[model samples]
Target: MTRRTSKLDRRLVAETALRLLNEVGLEGLTLRAIAHELDVKAPALYWHFKDKQALLDEMATEMMRRMAADTAAPPSDDWRDTFRTRMHGLRAHLLRYRDGAKVYSGTTFTDTSYADGMEENLRVLVVAGFTPRAAARAWLTAYSFTIGYVIEEQAMGPDPFAGTEGYDVEARAQRLAAYPLSAEAGREMFQDHERGFDEGIGAIIAGVEATLLRRGA
Candidate 1:
């Protein structure tokens, strides 16, 4: 079936932009491309979004909206566990499209869906003994860490050097022959990224709990 985008809504435009993001990434995403996908003239798109940035902002908002939906129903009552799970989930969602984290980072979401989720999650923390401000801070702290982490992890894309992004003990050893200790450190540092991600998030959650508990958050 042919899709008609003659009368477009912001949501429809944003959703189309998201599909383009998965296919062409952020750099290739353009108003013209979106128009082509929607089967409409590029000028018709401006009726919904003023410029690419406006469309991008809507895209970012839509990503958050999806994230909010994913985390809507908390599986656990333990605030720590809930926060940790959601952080991991957010990372997974952000990694879905190329430069997903960058897209989200570029714009602010001015939607109530995100706002409502924030308020509800903040209440969870507040009830768990965190002051209102502390609750917000704690969530933001986790959010910042998650986004930053996914950004870094995703940045190591497509084997930047010689198509050897996987385990290369021999190649690495030969490269670091002059510096044994540095090579060992590098090996350990880069090896087992999944473990590192898991541990890093675990530590963040534990650290937050300890700090907030000590300060009576």
Candidate 2:
């Protein structure tokens, strides 16, 4: 009964921590803050988590658990499509919370379930004729690109052009005149976030495919 109760408390603490992270982000998150939110003392949280990092690890695992679920739904015949869907889901989930990308980056989870999601991705690439090492490397490359892109996109704010609302197109053109290439391509450069994400994902997949083809030949 004591063990059962302890397990229950740990689960509750993890859930509450997740909620706090989504609400306040990592910077403002504290064991005391979470305890107070749960109407319990900070020491009570220590019983479950030794420190803030331990708590964060659990929270990050929870996020990956959700990602696993989102990605595990259906198998796609096209490996690229499967990978892109997973990335899209990840980006959408990360954007749901303030600083969600920051919380996810640089976090490692040894949870078998999350590993299963990655293994599934590896299987897709393997089926596409990639050697295991290449497939794994491609997965990491795609994951890194997706994470980096989301972080930058989030940092750019909701509207990249917000502050330039009053600026006329001619004025913008004049301002960018020194950089003729940028001036000519400025509109395309600041693409819709979704379009940019798709483009990046496509590029990564294409690069991996080209590498595989060259190796095969």
Candidate 3:
């Protein structure tokens, strides 16, 4: 059989790896698997990515690049509000593929390499009067939270509030027996993760503003 590659480059390899990632998840994602997706021999991929980690870095870059392309600033120019919108969009983007956050966490995010997209993120904060260090910290803090949040979100999978469904109604009720508030809180919290993420982001942004931007430290 002909090697499936059509002059494979880093972009093609990364894009193919991304699709495989969504289908098979991070653990299942391998260089060989990406090579198969690219219709090329595994070794053909090495001409573009030296190893799985290199491929992963490129994949992470692609994911972040796509998110930057997809994410739009909020209607208003208020930095905090715009930041919130971006954070929300970031969470949604990270959740696009299976174990997306896990893959992202592993990337080197090199400035001179494939799919490096953190510049705009840092620029926004720094332009808003954040010291370079503070801006990096702010973006990283929000990004880290989003990653951690999505890890939990994906793990929760289907029917997070298990007993809420009709089939498990009885079991759910019994499990929550004598703990009405716990059941109520779970339902409220899990039912609307967007709100929870927003709240957490709001807290982080607010804290940063109060402590860093205000104090000018």
Candidate 4:
């Protein structure tokens, strides 16, 4: 006879899986690994999640749930600042785990909890004078940019210039001689991705605001 799992067992399995994900990353995460981490057999994990994908989905949702909680209670006024702070918080949370963005981007949430967060974001945008449709579009665009940026940022790894660390200006110039404009931008371009991210995010917000204003006009 199979043993029934308690709520505690399910929570342990999920928490254990999260820890394993942090240690081994998405590629290395498996039911067997999670079970071993919990000092239980693989079947014990199946009692909670049917397979690796199911576990991954649960983990991804849990991450979003945390994000919703962390960013849920924003301060009143200054919607722009509120949105920016939320994005920053989301980025910080994703950075906490290995390949976190990869896992988050793979899953979708239509649950009430996530929907409430989305509704709140839209409400903020609408209160800032955006039409409902524009508010929705802006939220979706900002979300897409945030997710895409985080995935690329994480994939680029801790040291983006890992292979090009020793390459001097002249060496870089020679390497990019074929693409003069891109080459002329300098090694600083390769060194400061965070600045690029900030600039891009700023531009997105500005563009959305401009669209809203133009629509009103």
Candidate 5:
């Protein structure tokens, strides 16, 4: 038998880990699995990543890198439009992989590669008359909403598109048969998440303007 030799670095390790994530998900993902995918020993990964958390951080950074690269259109100047576009894009990005939101959540970015885009976002809000603090709050609010929404969205199962058979709306309605509205709500909640996300984010951005920006103005 011949020994397999491969060059290892943070990028390769992280990228490999990300590809495996769609198959194994966050729970099943392990350092050994990543090593196995790379055809290297588990110990070899440690030279690049101190632990699984470090590896996760890199995976998240790579996800963000891909998202940034994929976004070709120029960002809108209006703060609300900018946020709406970003949040929608984020949901789509996270939905691309199983448990993508989980991978992103709570992982400290391995580097400042995300800073420039972030800076531009904040600048847009500030230019639109948001005080710096208010801009941060508004961005955070929209961000939290997007992340949380995608977490639930991904939880619906493997099918990212609307009308995924994995989630049984009729069964849910039957389960809630005693309560008609609650029963009907299954279709709304489960059938089309895209619609819910759009409405929810619009309300959030509008609420921010009405409450925070207006009061400040």
Candidate 6:
């Protein structure tokens, strides 16, 4: 019923930090802030996490745990379809909180619970005729694309596409009147991120199929 407890643990601290993250965002979230939200002294958090970054790493791990729970099993085994589904699911997971992508990026996972899932992902590629190294590279490429996309998406606003809040094609066109094509291009580029995301994943998968799978590389 209460976030406060007699004993503070790493998981509780991480979960509290995640809830606070939505309220304060990454720039405002801090170990002290999390402690205050938990109704504990700042020093109590240090017993579980050595520092703020350590706490952040745990939070990212917790996010991954929730993501994994949403997909009980991997998707279909057609390598391209499987990867596309994974990338989309990953994007949804990263969009779950304020600055979710920023919180997830560059953090070392705190445990090995992710190993089985990673192995399963790589196995799908390998079974589809990718060399182990190529499979790893391909997966990483897709992952990097999703992370970068979501970071920019969150930057635009909580709901970048609800209206023309951050990406007003007309405004962009007006600002770049000297270049009609680049100005109008904003509609294609920013007007429909869902389409862009699907196309981007498709293009990446197609490229991998053309270059790696085709060449047996």
lDDT (Cα atoms) of all candidates against the true structure: 0.77, 0.72, 0.71, 0.71, 0.84, 0.84
Clashing pairs in 1: 129-217, 130-217
The superposed Cα distance between candidate 3 and the true structure at residue 87, in angstroms, equals: 0.8
Model 5 Cα shift for residue 202 (angstroms): 0.6
What does candidate 6 score on TM? 0.92
> Of models 1 and 4, which has the larger lDDT?
1
- Output the better candidate (5/6) by TM-score: 6
Candidate 1: tens digits of C-alpha lDDT, residues 128-187: 888887777788888998888767766654322223364555677789899999778756
Best by TM-score: 6
TM-scores, all models, native as reference: 0.83, 0.80, 0.77, 0.80, 0.92, 0.92
Point out where model 1 deviates above 4 Å: 158-182, 185-191
Compared to the true structure, candidate 5 yields what TM-score? 0.92
Candidate 3 residue-wise lDDT, 9-81, digit = tens: 7877787777767677777888877767767678877777778888878888788677767765443546687
lDDT by residue for model 4 (1-217), tens: 1233544355566666676777777788878877676667788677777777777777777787777777756666677776777677777788778778888886755245577777787888787788888887877777778778777666655622232242355677889899998788765544455677677778888898888645844
Question: Could you arrange the candidates by lDDT from highest to lowest?
Answer: 6, 5, 1, 2, 3, 4
lDDT of 6 by residue, 140-199 (tens): 999999999988878865353332356566887999999999997877777567788999
Considering lDDT, which of the candidate structures 2 and 6 is the better prediction for this target?
6
Regions of candidate 5 where Cα sits further than 4 Å from its true position: 1-6, 158-164
Q: Clashes in candidate 2: how many?
A: 0
Q: Which stretches of candidate 2 lie over 4 Å from their true place?
A: 1-8, 159-191
When superposed on Cα atoms, how far off is each prediction in RMSD? 3.5, 5.2, 4.6, 4.7, 2.8, 2.4
| Residue pairs with backbone overlap in model 6 | none
Ranking by TM-score: 6, 5, 1, 4, 2, 3
Compare candidates 2 and 3 on TM-score and give the better one.
2
Task: Give candidate 3 misplaced runs (Cα > 4 Å).
Answer: 1-5, 72-76, 110-127, 159-185
Worst 10 residues of 4 by lDDT: 159-168
